[model samples]
Target: MLPLLVVSALAAVQSLAYEQTLGFNSAPIVETRSLDEIYHAALAEGGVVTFWLGGDEKGDEDAIKKEFEGKFPGMTLNLTTDLSKYHNGRFDEQLAAGHVYVDSIAFQTVHDFPRWEEQGALLHYAPVGFDKIYPPMRDVRAAYYGILTVGWAGKWNTDKLPGIAAPIEWEDWLRPEFKDKLVLTYPNDDDAVLYAFDLIMQQYGKSWFERLLKQNPRWVRGTRTPDTVMQASNSSWAASFTSDGLFPTSNINVSHPVQGSFVTWFQLAAIPKDAPHPEGAKLLHNFMLTKEWQATRGSWPVRSDVEPPTGYPAIFEMPGTNITYFREWMSDRAKLERLRTWFEDKLGSAQGLSPLIDGI
Candidate 1:
């Protein structure tokens, strides 16, 4: 064996190297480095990155693969899109098995992230442009940040309801003339829809839902159904449609509620602690924050420097917009369950799988 002091010194060096590899530090550094620096570092470390995106596996594979590959010639981008709920379960399994494969995650399941942070499953690295992000959209601790803003608002088929005006308030749907003509996503089917109902109840009182129920408004299971119904002119109005500013039909007009609209949980992004390619993940995270990347998305970017697409107002400029803090709701599981039970009792069973719950 080598001398004791020499052996001890070597062991200490090895421990320090291990900690550095794991990104362990007294204060996690906020990544302010340039994209080029991160890119070269990523290339030096095998140049492979994986992202778990929320929602269906629509043609994002080709687009993201093309964009990232074009941007970083030598880097390899592995992109997978699945319902956030399914990804969450998959990630939990990965963590339990100590076999993490994903480098970064961008998803709509805002509730589970806080838990992940608490467990130290997340790497705390604020990407470049971190300071430019909207204050409410980023975590104070810099564990995770909101990259996009999606709103739940009222919409209608203008061609079908030429004589009728879009609803400017929650109570506008309760108009006697609109009875049985309004459609909304079932509150129990989605957390965002449930939060919207809670907001309406809080602002208008408990009897607000009771009165709206009296109108015989149809309740569907998915958020997309309301928008689809409105597009097809099957419903006069949809009460809780997500406005992405990319509707397939021009006849369907979406408007934020005059009284206020709910900014459903922001689509959140974070790096897992055991990511295989931290530099690649960091490079991708920084790239996402760029105005160039944000401008391509239908949802509003969380970065203040990025201008929203023409016709849509900037997030801060929107009047009476309530940002829903999903962390609070997730903490109160009992209340969520109770509310779900109550809604089912009143509105009947939800017809289909909630994209939030069933990952459909």
Candidate 2:
């Protein structure tokens, strides 16, 4: 009898997964209302709507708030910032316990999507105008798409790395002169950084540790940290994985080291499954994706109809390489811990890291 019950429970769980995964997932356009109506409705709304703004996006909140206020009059955004040290860790607990402090999140891909999706944290939702989203942008089951668009490339201070071309054809980070000078963010923390290394090694060579050793570099907690350091002139960062759409100043130029292979990664926005206020969430989601909001933020918008703001570098102008899933490069669940140990012990040394170019 106990065995039969266990089998029955497993079948029930499988049934639910099928319903959600293959469910009616389509993007629906969110309706709008008057400012007064919108504000009152949101204030009296039944559930809370929470969003996460990472360090890079903290600057865009004002535009986000203004745009929401203008578009979906009654929708309440509950605008907030959460830099909780344990972002990925806490998400695990919350999703497992089913505590949805985060109604929606705007974060990187490193483990946000795959990890959360595995836990059934993502709600299968498609907002209005979903058809407009590019294939890579839409997640058939996650109910979120990348709204803030940016391209990836090796950026540097031309004044510092003199004699180097706009984009040096760099296959690894361990050139002798570049050793210890390479400014990099750990990909384990930021998937974009992870993807950058994977792309470099995959296209160039696996034993690329030689490149890292030559350019002895410092480690920053966040990808932006290294980029900011490069901008402030703290160190001469010969090459780094960063968003080309943004620069510390005009002095920073984004270049394709390899003429035709620039890899671009998108930061995503998503709604939670089992949301208390799904309708309100939908309204907010669509409002954020609109051209007006994206243009006002001075960031690249995913929509083709929207032209980039003044002085904005076109993401498409650079040759784009798509980032595919890499379990080995991800270091997976076990490898990540192994990497953390390796980083703190072996790679942490200030000495130039020899590029592990062969037999990797």
* Top candidate when judged by TM-score against the true structure: 1
Ten residues in sequence with the least summed lDDT for candidate 1: 12-21
lDDT of 1 by residue, 1-360 (tens): 899866765654343223232544425558867899999999999999998887633443357778888999999989887667678899876766566899999877787877777667788888888888888888766788987666655676667666676667877777775676677777876666777777668789878888987988777655656655666543455344433343335566666666755545577899988899999999888988888988887767788888876676886676766454654665577898888888889888878654334432
Model 1 stretches astray by more than 4 angstroms: 1-26, 43-47, 56-66, 73-76, 233-249, 308-314, 324-327, 353-360
On the 0 to 100 scale, the lDDT of residue 117 in model 2 is 60
For model 1, how many clashes? 0
Q: What is the lDDT of candidate 1?
A: 0.72
TM-score, model 2 to reference: 0.68
- Report per-prediction Cα RMSD to one decimal: 7.4, 7.5
- Looking at model 1, residue 201 earns an lDDT score of 80
